[model samples]
Target chain A: MIDEKELVIALKSQNECERAFQILVNLYKERLYWHIRKIVLNHEDTDDILQNTFIKIYKNIHKFEEKSKLYTWMYRIATNESITFLNKKAKKKNITIEEVKNQLIENLESDIYFEGNQIQILFQKAINTLPQKQQLVFNMKYFEDHTYENLSEILETSVGGLKSSYHIAVKKITAYIKLNETI
Target chain B: MKRRENIDKFKVPTNYFDEFENHLLNKINEEVLPKNIGFKTPTGYFNKLDFNIKRKNNSRLKEGKLIPVVSKKTFMYAASIAAMVLLVFSVLKDATRVYTLEEIEISSIENFINEGNIQLKQHEISILFTDEILNNITSNQSRLSGNQLENYLLENINDLNALLPY
Candidate 1:
């Protein structure tokens, strides 16, 4: 693993950028890809957003102020790019974001990327019913096990705010599953 | 309790990350290498772009060249107006020129008086015919003879007291 500060210094330096960036991509691609896949729910879409996220990070690395860890900044970019991609897909289909989510849920069975059992499918449906922010809060905490403090830095929100959103998200998901689960 | 069985539902093919870099590098090279960009440009836009930009810049440089030529023509018009004003002023001055008295001639007075209207009173005529000319006439014996004088005296004997106060 590359030292965070050293990677940042090389990323900011013009001479060593190509090699440093390649390293950066190699290191974070899996973690970032899973994080995006959780939101977008398909491999191809995740791959698409992941590519955009790294390109965005490479382009804006000079403006990285070293205020946060490099991965956290990359997470922030990945989060934004995924949201933007979903919104674009929603617009292209002339549907609201909620309608788009429902459509994605309907198409999950046929999607080669998704191989979840019935419970997992219900889990995805319950998660999709959430507001966009609550969905993010739940996914990062539940799957990635991201701490509230770290989530705060990546999301630029207060830790207390993140906890409140996370708890609310959990309650909603549990309630949605209890209400809708067939067996 | 059921939610606690947090088996991560998503999966990737084995060694996906191990192979991801090369694919990503290929994608990145296709995107970032400039020559193999993933985006498509309009047809022939590059072929025409250089010619178009240079034509516009050359037009702009040509536009910059136009200003001084117009100023030169304006300067020429001003100079011609000044010359015309000076020529008219010199011609008018010569037309009004004043000559010295030495340069002028006084013609014959008799010819001038004869040509012009002149009148004289009897007293003015007496001044012109002076007493000396009268005396010269009276003293000449050839002009009045003694016998003619005696005869003129006898003829004017009754008017002698009025004619000669003595």
Candidate 2:
């Protein structure tokens, strides 16, 4: 595997950028797709956001200053794109962003792409109750297994703040699941 | 942490991610994206970096110029055209409809009027008396039908009294 330095250098190079980009896509596509899918809850939407994320990365490669790791920068872009996609959907439907999230949860039962069983559905509903930022923190920390330090860098939050948000999110999810669980 | 919490609840189709990159590449541009790449980075990678940068730019992925058939604007245009077509068809259907006195049994007309389905606006009833129609009524001085007294009196009382001159 090419190290970060070589990847950056190659991505910046006009001649070798495409090959470097392909490598980048191969490495990160699934990770980013899942990241987006958890928020959007729609396979087609995740696919769309994933495509846009890569395209945005390709377009802006020359402008990347490398102050942050490329993956971190890409994650931030993907998160923003997912939020933007949600906001646009809300506007189109004349619903609040919260309502859009609720609608997505409702759609999950009927969505052919959703394979989650009842517990997972309840898990999603619990996650949906958190503030969007906390939801991001929890998903990254819990599912992606991102360390506080890594998530701090990727999310541009202090490690302490990320921890607090994740802790709160976990507690809320637990309470919600227990409150609604069937015997 | 519970053991169950560690297990993944969400699932995707088999090989969904493994098949993703190549399919994505094909969707973007089948011909442009490089398929075969075996990475073996030897020592002195930094030394060859400048040589690699100076090589041909032909490997660069050209932005895929999407050929559009039915985009948002196209769909919107189609919807508006469909709406307009429906509007025109309804209007034309209404305009071309006619009811001749000979085709109707009087009782059906009476039933329609009694049911309030045949109700006409006052202004619409006024339009039934063109100047030619009034002159024909006065010239022939014939059958008066369908609230004809109010219609003729409203329009032609002076003409009637002048013709009687009594």
Each prediction's TM-score versus the true structure: 0.52, 0.53
Runs of candidate 2 exceeding 4 Å displacement: B1-166
lDDT tens string, model 1, B106-165? 555455556855665768877877799967877895678886785565445422212321
Cα-based lDDT at residue A127, candidate 1: 79
State the interface C-alpha RMSD of candidate 2: 27.3
Candidate 1 wrong stretches, greater than 4 Å: B1-166
Each candidate's interface RMSD (Å, one decimal) is 44.1, 27.3
Clashing pairs in 1: none
lDDT of 2 by residue, A1-183 (tens): 679889989999989987888778778876887788888887767766777677667767777778888888888888878987776677578677789988888888877766567677777878889998998997887667788888998777997688567666777776777788754
Q: Which whole-number lDDT from 0 to 100 does residue B95 have in model 1?
A: 71
TM-score quality measure for candidate 1: 0.52
Cα error, residue B88 of model 1, in Å, equals 35
lDDT of each: 0.70, 0.71
| Residue-by-residue lDDT tens digits, candidate 2, B1-166 | 5767767666887877975764454344323212211112235633443333333122333334555778989899999999999999888786767979999998998898889987788888778899898788787766667667644553444222123211
